[model samples]
Target: MRAMEPDRHSYISGVLVMEKTKLLYQQMYSGKVFTWIHLMPIFCSSMVRAQIQTNSDSKNLVTHKPTPTSEALSGVTVEPTRKSRSDSERPESLSKDLFTMSNLSVSDPELEKPANGSYSDVYEKYVLPCIAEFLGTAFFIFNGCASVTENTEGTGHLQPALAHGLALGIAVAIFARVSGGHMNPAVSLGAALIGGLNIFLLIPYWAAQLCGGMVGAALAKAITSDVKFFNATGAAFKSIERDEQVGSAIVAEVVMTAYLVMTVCMGTINKKSTTTLAPLCIGLSVTVGILAGGSVSGGCMNPARALGSALVANYWDYHWVYWVGPITGSLIVGLLLRVFIGDQKIRVLMT
Candidate 1:
């Protein structure tokens, strides 16, 4: 009986050790998965941004003062020519690039008319822009949602706010030349209304942005543990606690999104306000919105972002708040810009 008792105890100890080993293995595996998911988007986005900035810098090198010729270097008396006025002394040339599209449209006379059914023209004019939107939105979502999942220490909203802001700024800068950097559907709607984007591209851009959002959220989920993902509610909107709070949540979202879209329109689409720093200004607006409205509505100023996380978490409660609020907010901003705030060239009423 004594020998039998020792064997029984040994069996129990061995089973306990096996269970612990299994648990530890799972935790380590999940941690690795989380780290990869969290870092992949960030690393990729950073690399792309760096490459784009390098190209921009190289291009700007041509604008530098010309090198001295051999005659000048040999101390020949070269006549000094009067320098042109500094940039600040002259009116800033209105930028018409992808990021600054004040009065351009699909049917603008300035744009080259492509032949009917030309696949190459269609690909260059439309498909490439949509692809840029997809990549921009995807990386932005992955970074933002992953940040939310990372906020496990009960810290204030600042962490996710900064994450969203920095991600959006980097994404906008990366894609500004290709797609105008309107990652949000609300921003696209605003741009379309203001003639900064072609009206025909609205639905396509929205679809691309939404699809990107889903992909980003899925990537975020893959990187996080089941517990953290569930706890974060998959980074979906959930601040509204009661039916009465719904009204305030809707209002908060509308106001917050209005601010975001307004910044987009003014900083990127309005010639009077457009600057090289437009992307940074727009990103800061997002950070402000999230910080101010986060407690009331979870600060989801982007419907694409909200929808992506909601789909991942399967949490549908008050889901309409995200869509209705941001769209309405953007609509209001668009109307204001078209009627009053836009430059004289683009305004519909005052112009």
Candidate 2:
């Protein structure tokens, strides 16, 4: 039996090696699944406050009434009144991805039912809307780009795609009521073309969004790991070197942006109960775009985001592809929706 000792030792070593390999793969899979979830705390501050409160009209936020143990003799009964959607506000706008019916509803309000009613009054009345856009865009850029900063190969678009999709959904859920959650300049322009937004407000939304993107990108650079590698790579969008063509890149961007903008417009058309889940749909559209276009044009539907990263890294490789492709696609889709989709004539405040 002494001669067999070496064989036993070899078998034990092989088993140990197999276990270690399995552990490594498990860790990698977990990282991909939870990457987007972990980024939530990094950029979710302020955007989620008061947005999730179920009772919009309730002055009090406290829900505590009595503990089960403390009220053994006489239990305290607490019944909270729930607020339901009213009829005064029904037909929602096309620019928004989610559904809201209250006067406080920040998604797309009608052209006549501006938060302040008239461009002149918007500055004082709904200035918070601009700030909402700023913060929303910033959060998107910071979290979304964080993944791209690490995914230099572009094949790892899976992580970046998931990050961007989930980030946009959360941002929209929190800020859609205030600013219509137009994180992309392309989205704002399309909404403007469709008469869903004030024609004059488009530029302002663009500026705020762009500024947010720049600040978010800069802040992301400061906080993320491997700054040297990220900076060296410039974190700019590039076509997959092997099979990328200028025409194909343009088409990919145009198609993906079209899908995104179209989903936003159609998702809120008072069609289904799922309208309230517009944020998820819009986010999914972004994910789908990345899946379809990441290899071709970096799947950049937002020019502001592209511009922000380009400025930070001083990298402009095929930068125009982002702007031109998304813009063209958004314009065409907006006009198509206007001509064929029919007027919505939405109400302002919920009853």
Error of 1 at 93 (Å): 35
Report lDDT per candidate.
Answer: 0.80, 0.70
Q: Cα deviation of 216 in candidate 2 (Å)?
A: 1.0
For model 1, the run of ten residues with the poorest summed lDDT: 90-99
TM-score of candidate 1 against the unseen true structure: 0.67
Compose the digit string of candidate 2's lDDT tens values, residues 204-280: 88889999999988887886676653653545676645444888988988989988888776665424322888899
Q: Which regions in candidate 2 have their CA more than 4 angstroms from the true location?
A: 1-126, 151-155, 225-228, 240-244, 269-274, 344-351
lDDT of 1 by residue, 238-258 (tens): 897789998998899899888
Task: List runs of model 1 lying over 4 Å from the truth.
Answer: 1-117
Give the best candidate by TM-score: 1
